[model samples]
Target: MRGIQLQLSQTQKVRLQKALEQLESLSSKVNSDASVTIADSIPVNHEDGVLKGHGTTDLNGEVVATLCGVVERVNKLVYVRSLRSRYKPEVGDIVIGRVVEVAQKRWRLDINYSQNAYLMLSAMNMPDGVQRRRTALDELNMRCIFEEMDVICAEVRGFQHDGLHLQARSQKYGKLSTGQLLTVPPYLVKRQKQHFHHLEQYGIDLIIGCNGFIWVGEHVEARDDMVEDQVNQTDPQVLIPNKDSVSFEEQEKNYTALETRKYICRAANAVRVLSSLGFIITLEIIKGVFELSLSSNLDIHDMLGSEFCVLVAEKEAERRSSNKKKR
Candidate 1:
């Protein structure tokens, strides 16, 4: 398939063209040698092929991909290229992100994208027996439920000017404290979206996002070394679910929960090891580093899980900086 670009309507085109022309004139004066270029930056498969913006010019006349989209007169700055696809969470998409900042009405998540996402108190499912609307007390109690670095499974509610908003309507979607956080480059993470699973052998659960933010955790308190033992066993007996005792739906849900837990835990372990090594890792990096195959013991979650530990690394760096200050 051909590479995709964002599409734009005629009105958007006219607006972009005018901006480009103005930017070109400005560029000529700003840097006599540098060229201000704008090509058809829309994606082929993008239904809304909007010309979002242009790129940036360095002092040495080299060009870089634009980080922010254009808003015409706001920046009057010549856009050099359209923003690269960063895979921020969208409405209705399931994602996993680490809680970074906790505020009055929302929690901030670094979703491995351009913008930090917001998880609002209003978006959360209220208590089972509560008859009234969520109160400030509810928010405070909920605040205690999540601390910095908690991994959460949530659905993107929508995007606002502030950031991407997330909702956790189910018990499955809240307070993921016992897990390792993984961070990968956004693009490769998107490619492995369909393969999320939890392996019974691995005793882990995995939550994957297009932005490369993965959350991994143990399904139960199992030893790390026991993982290999369980996965290597050929007992087809253990793999089969008990069909006689439960309804198909119940069985299916149980199997899914088990699988999700296993995948997340295994990925968390893998990510923890790699992130400790101080590499700016991606899903591709993990796949390459581990030398894994598609059909191997590792799953899509394992690859993206290699990018884990941004928060821990940041904290360590801060600690060192503080220690150095004391010296």
Candidate 2:
């Protein structure tokens, strides 16, 4: 209950416990009532307990229901209907992930499920805006876009025909180049609906997965004035402004955006990596991973390696492909 957010209050917990105890105490007396037959076995009708149901057994040797009032007949099925949650990944779902390994032309991601998900090089879009099939030149470094601890977001691309392939693709789907990653419980991740949808508010690129993996990184906000500052395509916005002359409002907004972006980015990356390790990716885990001298060691530049993380992710994808066949 401590781990679950939807836990009952202390008063409710005590009341529920008392109610269960009362039920247990009254159970025997109710069964022995005269109106009840107390048959060698509960009747089939009562067993299901559906119709003033009594605990009864059927030919299949299963209890269908638990009857409370009278044991009218024997040799009947009675039991409470059991239920279970049976959900699987879906397309278009935004997922937070870490590149666990890279092999060949793919990246493997731990999407907080039983199996690590895959992202293929062919699914990658080139920076030059050229739409060509991924080539040998696209050989993954396994650490470029998705490092061992990088967090990323992408759309669910549907599984392969073999039922083993888990893919995520789309331009909207890409690596979080800056931010923190945090890992909450899998249950919390499942209940979250707006995963990665509100990053613009905080200026962080956030990705989350049902498996409790999350990635956070910094993203520079689009600047209206900077739009006209694009002097060259290769090296846009060359004019440097004096740091002291910047207005308080602009500076405040930029600083706030930068700080929020870094905070979320780090949280997201830490969450994804933590999810992959099957542990709660806390600030402690992050410090340990980077071997930081101090908390301040948690800088974006140290952890956000775009190319390296990507290659690591690709390797993970290759590993997932291999495991799927064995399954």
Candidate 3:
């Protein structure tokens, strides 16, 4: 209901309701009473003292929710995980953010948090992937590494004197070129051990950034920009006509392969549809949706059609039911 704005026929509405009901039924088995709305009192009457946590408040000796989300009880601790909110970064969380500003010693990134995240030049690995100290020249040429508006992937490196800090200490965490950045409610993406996926069959890399910024693009090996001391990088074969480079025609020519691009579009559309339905996004589930599209022979553009939406909902209902039975 967060972003759903569909006008369905009576029949479609009934079917959707049935599917959603089935999903609710499956979810109800797991402490169904845990769902709460704002100001709702959580049903916890334990003798022991319960520590109030985020999204919770003490109201007249009762624990009440400050957000509309499901209540979770971890041992003696009780808290509500808000279904709608910006990303809450934890240490080691892999995130995708856009460079918003090049500050004196850091790059401010808009990573869907309440405040901008900082990526200090000193925290990042050197351009050559060497363990060298950051130099003043590096600070001067900060834009060269990450200009404003560039999509970057990094890890949360704990808070600092400057605030929420991010680090790109590995080859995998740096500038993200030639990709589609998809935003969804951060809760939809479950924290997993691995977020980066290389779909070899499609020749695309799927980076499920924990901050809800998903990236889909042509697959490329991670290599340091400084490591490329190749002759071509040092000198151009042809003379440039003007200071303005990367002409429109040349840029198009450098685009991902035709088939790979098609796959990227299809994957991105599949993700869009899933996010619209408020589905829990995981690598396996996303791949299942892609296979569903292929099996139904739905065109890339038709994945968003009303019929497809209904089908996806029904399919999800079935999948959840099957999982419940397995459990």
RMSD of 2: 17.6
> Across residues 105-153, which tens digit of lDDT does each residue of candidate 1 receive?
7889866667788888777755442235666555545445565776767
Cα lDDT, all candidates: 0.51, 0.47, 0.83
Best by TM-score: 3
lDDT per residue for candidate 2 within 232-294, as digits (tens), equals: 233323433443476878656655454675556455554444343233333334434333212
Question: Which of the predicted structures, 2 or 3, would earn the higher lDDT when compared with the native?
Answer: 3
Error of 2 at 42 (Å): 17
Query: lDDT score of model 3?
Result: 0.83
What shift in Å separates residue 95 of candidate 3 from its native position after superposition? Answer: 0.5
The Cα error of candidate 3 at residue 130, in Å, is: 2.3
The best-first sequence of candidates by TM-score reads 3, 1, 2
Each prediction's RMSD over C-alphas, in Å, is: 19.5, 17.6, 3.9
lDDT of 3 by residue, 247-293 (tens): 88867865888899889989998899889988888988888889899
Point to the candidate with the largest lDDT.
3
Worst 10 residues of 3 by lDDT: 226-235
